[model samples]
Target: MSGLAAGWASGAQGRTARSPGIAVTIDDFDLTDTPLMSGEERDAAIRAALARHRVKAAGFVAGKYVGDSLDPAVLARWSDGGHILGNHSFSHRYFGGEDPAGFMADVLKCEPLLSGYAGFRRLFRFPYLAEGKIAAGRDTMRALLKRHGYRNAPVTIDTSDWYVDNRLKARLLADPRQSMEPYRRFYLGHVWERATFYDGLAQSLFGHSIDHTILLHHRLTTGLFLDDMLAMFEERGWRLVDADKALASPLLAREPEGLPAGQSLVWALAKADGRYEGRLRYPGEDGAYEAPRMDALGL
Candidate 1:
């Protein structure tokens, strides 16, 4: 059986009338400045929403921004509230674009900072999902991570908030009259595309559930829609696995699958029928969201 299939077999053996099939993960919890609140206040606002939903999810935080003490304090709260901390890399730079050694250093710096309070963080989501071209792709990243005992996250769905706010920003610049509605609407529109991308990814990759990880951003724009985000997870009947428990999967023991896939089916399905406004028409659309990628996103 494939490594993916082994997961199905284990789930089948443990199945009961009440067993569930999948789960979702959310991260990229970064915030700098905002119009409505200070950075700390915004963090509190987002945390308030998570607490209110009684939702437990993961936050792939920037180690330097939160600082060691702040990183652990916030992570512990999220973990206690039911969220896990994944690696966003200490710098949150585009890891795939950097020199092999330089990239590994920045990435590894995050863990020791977190380990100062939390111990080693085993799960890694490449900054920006930027796993470049194939042979060169998996060769450097997978090997470097293996050297440090980190697992590459298999992202089945991406909320793509990274593009949303950037697009929102340009809109405000080009057409200053455009109101906050655009940002609000894009934020609200993510849940549908999120599920579609996630489901499509499952069918393509594992042919079944297999603990899929869904990427989310803690960017303030994403915060606008977070209450709904958490509700989607709860309503879907999934629980956030503790990052520690999540890391223990054998999938992490080595490269879970081969390197840089040129196209994940989720992207194709998303292209044809994705309804999430954020992914549907990004930075080009009217919103504070910046950043646009025609090639990488295949839009």
Candidate 2:
């Protein structure tokens, strides 16, 4: 969880591209056995939603989670349907509980599964967001990506649903006052806040149009609330592309011949400017806009 404060650093040279269309991506697709339903069952629900809303979503799945082994058939459904598979690691450890090398190994171990997905690969999303867990951990991970011929996936907006209790329908079920309960914080709210945060962030960052990789969990609660979530997408008129498209990171301009992915990374944490002006990834946040303390990033 400390990764929340410390993300890996990367130095991609690609100019930032923002579009009015939204790119929706969901994580932990193979993650089941909880308040949410099974991955297969969830897929059905998701398909129904896609057809209902005419929007497509990217499913970031664990290669090993499908039948506890690399099941190509299961993975194919997603790719065949035009949904992409994202890497989430072989084992879903709540806490990575190791150093950069250990963390990299944990993620790399799942490469077989990731690469096995329809033979079209090149994207990775940290389980629970590596950026937040280890400061500049994104650097270590990015190095891995470069070596493996993959790219870093950055999430512009995130939903806190997975971390909290299973209140999948809380916002929908909430009364006016209950809805306001989650909004005690100035910028964050309970029910409408998740959607509101992305919607507003989208408006502010790209002004109602931009390619965004949003982090959402594939869980029973989210599955239950799928209808409500899709409604917002329609209201916003965003085109749902495979979430993998969002992993566009800055690359080295020189394009060195044989650099390891770890060697290619910059290793810094990204900080959001409070004024909505711009966001910068730094080693640390200092005095509101400077680099933050690495110690705070769990680096």
Candidate 3:
């Protein structure tokens, strides 16, 4: 195991050890009605699912989505349900191509909207998971976050759940009575596959399983099947932990030396190490990668 990996596992023996654990971290709370449900209805369903599983998720909210058109109470629901709210920037700008001052200003702009929530935390997730394309840019942002007492929220198991949701919505719009079984199966299978792949990579790189945070979004797909997803993890011998607890893992705090700095944290670390080239992919997970597989299934 590498020194970085060793550091991640240093205090493991003292904790209540179990199988690899994961926490739910949702991003882009884009509140809009879809073919399947109204925005409010979707929010209720997602909250109910989380309540059913007793999971406290971290919701990363982008400020632009929280407008006068939508009720602010929709966001209060997350806080009421005991989930933490984090900043995902105001404009949801891609930081890799953004001017540093503008990006920093956008992040600061989103902070006020979240401050009122009892569950608010000074955790910031980069929109599109793009930190920056250069070392100086990445470090400048990092320094700003540090000075503001914000921790960069990193994703470990990144999935294309948004893509699956898009297809499912389109199918529903075409035929509301279409059997959802196929969509359910595909979503579950895709998530599990990515989970195992990342878990294996983490074990190989860290020589131990680090607590993971799976990147999901607030969408119809998550609202409908989050309960099933949580059950799947539990049945597979993985512990479902609180988002804050999972995020506290020391490994998440380590910044990789790679120039174009963000992806799944494990992927970025491996890229920095330069030994896992064959097993990694650039832009770790995206809709494009899943398009062909879904097309083959006619989904």
Candidate 4:
């Protein structure tokens, strides 16, 4: 009857014409420089890509990364462009490593810095996506979030852009003149594989497509490759939507039943269902698929 419903039916019927929607949310707004460029330069490149694509992202800022120097200006560039800013913790400490109270304090400490931005929203993505070690710890943090009126940001398409950036940074530092073709190919293929898997999982679990929230980072690799990444998504038929729209998916409201609960919401939900546990990958965020290739390339 409705266009969306009709599209869902077509997808349900195994039509290849339907494509999923997704939004980009970048984490750890650390402006530290990489071997190829200064922090400002990297930020400029990322901004340029966002501008060219006319895309706005939700940038979660770690207060520890912001200071009196050039960091505020970098944040301004994002907020000034109508991008949303969210809390990413003060010290980027893992909740599992620290007590629940300590972790909440770390989250609260970052609020002022996030509130300083005009686009600040009461959305919080965990450091390392580490919510807690057990049920009690997870519940503790959830209660704290409710009291503070913060929405927990859930990533649907999780990626390891940070690890790739680390390896790329190391290689660039070793030899700036080395060709980047191998790195680019590996990055694109790896991301594409993950995206396909997650999108398929969403369809299988929900009987239709849900807006996917992708987890990326503020790093040299993304700054260098995001434009191409977005292009690849476009070519694959994905329609990029705003972060808020993606996060508003009703599917995100369901809390999974177990502990060690820091993962993409999709993965957590699948685990809760227990029907597709075998499909779920452990330590969902890593560069294992690309590690050997990177090693062989001498990166």
RMSD of 2: 10.4
| Clashing pairs counted in every model | 17, 38, 0, 0
Better of 2 and 4 by TM-score: 4
**Superior by lDDT: candidate 1 or candidate 3:** 3
lDDT of 1 by residue, 1-299 (tens): 22322333332353333322233455555556655444556667677876786544556766666653254465666655655666778877764434767777887788765554343357777765665544565577668888888767655455556667566655555776766664665454554445444443354443444344456565656556666655655555544344444445553343323233312224423343434334333211221322333222322
State which candidate has the highest lDDT: 3
Worst 10 residues of 2 by lDDT: 4-13
Taking the tens digit of each residue's C-alpha lDDT, what string does model 4 give over 71-160? Answer: 688888888998889999998877883478888888899999878778899998998888787888898888888889988988888888
What is the C-alpha lDDT profile of model 2 across 245-285, one tens digit per residue? 54453421212222111110212111222443243223111
Arrange candidates by TM-score, descending: 3, 4, 1, 2
Q: Estimate each model's TM-score.
A: 0.65, 0.61, 0.92, 0.91
Predicted structure 4, TM vs. truth:
0.91
The C-alpha lDDT values of all candidates are: 0.53, 0.48, 0.85, 0.79
Better of 1 and 3 by TM-score: 3
Model 3, position 164, has a per-residue lDDT of: 98
